[model samples]
Target: MSPQQKALLLPKKQGNFEIGSRSIPSPGAGALLVKIHSAALNPVDYKIKDLGFFVTDYPAVLGSDIAGIVEEVGEGVDNFRKGDRILAHGKFSNDFAAFQQYTLTDARFTAKASYEKIPSSESFDSAATVPLGLDTALVGLHGNHFGAGLTPPWTKSVGESKKPIVVIGGSSSVGLYAIQLARLSGFYPIITTASPSNEELVRKYGATHFFDRNLSGKEVKAAISKITDSAIGIVYDAISLPETQSVAWELLANDGTLVLTLPASVKEDEGKGRKVISTFAGPHDPQNEELCSSSWAVVEKWLSEGTIQPNKYEVLPNGLEGIIGGLERMKLGQVSGTKLVAHPQETQ
Candidate 1:
């Protein structure tokens, strides 16, 4: 029998998550076998168990933010070797997901998905918070199909944008990355809305202006009008709840794109040329493959240079088992301004 690893499993559609055993998988061509150290929880993880979307296989594992050590490098891969610490976004497939002690990753996404070394400055918990949030923001801001179609900062000299961009829920994981990427793209007065308590946190991520997230849509809009007259061309709503979506729609200008992490609750008006793009951020998706590959190539530099900072995270107790209560807290809106991380290797 193959070596076994502990996993958090959802035995059926809408089933409860339980600790179970799964065989540690081997790396295939252009892939690496990872011994997962830390896995970060996302709202989607709990949503999957409740709504039963984005996954079809039964008795499956679910998680997307992965940080670990490479255990084996597969045929045709040379950039990574055993014992290298790395972080990569997980896929929905059982063998590639993050809720297990071991998972497989594509070494680099030239024409595939990617994995890269964690910067020495970061801990596994901090690095685990980055993958899904950063990818969601990147695809929403730069992907032609799912994003606003802005030129990526890594590409040849398209000068910085002088315009302003709004990010609702700026303290949220995706929102924080949006603020940073908007700064990198040269969007001035990078306006964001979050709890007043998180103003400093969002600003540290490059939000030039901040507003209380509790404000009414019109009130926030009126406040923003004073900051920049430049038409708000992109509104990345990381929260994507009904109320937040309404505020994002209210602030978006004509011909602007509203980027959502969830399905759009507000309809787009065709006559105004405004668009509502719900981003599916997993790099494994064909639509996002190329754009994400380009970004992944630079992630190591981004982290090391502090060009993109990882989210603040709190490590949960009890390793993998603690993720259950963390998800419950997330569902109750109890977790705020921080990612919850679990140490899978610490599982009993």
Candidate 2:
């Protein structure tokens, strides 16, 4: 490997992260060592840090989203040799994560990448914003019985059934991508809730109609009903709120599916037949890496062709040492409308 390297280090307990020197991670058999150019912080990033969601070790290097170049390939690691540009969701275990000068990656999740041919003036930050959102959005759409140009709920044939899919928070990182995805699935009205400022933007992403539902589940249900001209077929909540499931239940069509990043509390409501699909989705191991790798290529090709634009981002200065401050900005909710990305090498 490359000897010692600096990494944004998260302490074992809940606390702020620091940049520390550590031995460069060597890619074991079936892994590739990535030289990270930038990493994106998810809400789960902080929740995992401060609240300690799913942790297996302390002083874990906490970045799960990364975009960079492959500096070295481990034995048996093909597909992505050294010098390939790639992006990946951090392998669940910190040992296989991003946020350092180097990250250990699953070879399957990495893919050959070049930003779609644009004006050739775009920066890495712009090109770096789509992977995580795109992957999760795609997964949620499918899990909730929706797919690109296909009726939701995998079935036998066209005579099988039809359903309405509702996408709440259609302007979030996942929500924005969900808008376009639901449209591709041919979901009618593609109901979304966003601030007035984002209504037009969400509509462009393919929301058939828009509504300004701030928090009232009543308003949210009413809006979706009006847009669909009936009950919602399926519901997908990108926002990780505990009560979103309840809101979804109120508008669901009979036997409709509900998908969430968090567990929706549908069982306690006594609706035994309703389906509660928990999207416990994140970076899966070997089985999912290949799927993610291919989906990324599709999303990237769309971006390159201007079929989609990367989500907005806030580029923080100061690199490694600056991560603490950036994390705080995200904690305070100041970093909305964009993802926060940092380049540790630039700070180095």
Candidate 3:
């Protein structure tokens, strides 16, 4: 009936999030109006927020990962209904952002569950964390643009290769999700690198071998070969430093596949048939749009079963007002292995 919804406003280039009144959007056909419960903060949030690369305009509402309830569904929508408990990785183009009390979501991006029976086992703060990280991981795994279709060539059987992919940053939100998804997909021998303190923590997420990144690439490669038995297959480089990408490439067995979150200095090695891949993380990819619903279904199943867990979160308790500082901190790399969550309930 009226407007004046509070949003975490991004006022200008290098600007941060803030609380400000905004209109509550009405959903069009195929879109649902969700009363936002939580907004998951991602590295990309700060990347675009501080750098001003993707803003349609200044003073934008910045959030792409969200979890909440569908308060209203637009005409022609049958996949979800009023009061359905759901979470989503919003389409970044419409900026189906959730730093506000309410936002638009296409039926495609949402995953539904009944909050009553599930008891909201994962807190709102933790729930939104999964959609982004898990979606990214799931897409990489499902694409199989990688070598041996996510299992290494040398493995005895595809079924025995859990974590066959050696993800370089296993403790990262995306990296952690990739490890779990790899485990879920029956890929064994998952290898990853992080701070030494994170070994056991990441192992719980299905990282069969957690190496210290501080080690030389030669040492890291040896560790990888030990579990994968000298057969490195698919690799997901969640943290893509140019040097790191080169290191990941070395570990790949000849004719291996390496998928980097960012494009790296990978070239066609004449003797080795390794292929390099770059993935777009959200709805932008025509490939991703088709996979969105199915992928979310897979992620939702794991969530329901408690087979995967959220990254550690520095969840802000307030709504939009509390988000500004969090975004700034994210820019400085202050939030590592911990997601910054925004609660939109107060504003809603």
Per-prediction TM-score to the true structure, in the order listed: 0.95, 0.85, 0.88
For every model shown, the clashing-pair count is: 0, 9, 8
Most lDDT-accurate candidate? 1
* TM-score of model 1 (CA atoms): 0.95
lDDT of 3 by residue, 82-148 (tens): 9887888775543378788889887777777443324575556677887778767766666544212
Model 1 sits at a Cα RMSD from the real structure of 2.6
Model 1 clash pairs are none
**Full ranking by lDDT:** 1, 3, 2
Write the residue-wise lDDT of candidate 2 on 61-164 in tens digits.
87767777888889897667777777766655655676777788776555444665633333455655666676677766663232222333222223312346
lDDT of each: 0.88, 0.67, 0.73
Q: State how far residue 105 of model 3 sits from its true place (Å).
A: 1.1
RMSD, each candidate, Å? Answer: 2.6, 3.8, 3.6
Point out where model 1 deviates above 4 Å: 109-122, 157-160
Candidate 1 on 181-291: residue-level lDDT in tens?
A: 888888888999999989999998999899999998899889999988888888999999999999999999989999999999999896989999999888988888888
Best by TM-score: 1
> In terms of TM-score, how similar is model 3 to the real structure?
0.88
Reference-based lDDT, residue 223, model 2: 57
Off by over 4 Å in 3: 93-95, 113-122, 144-158
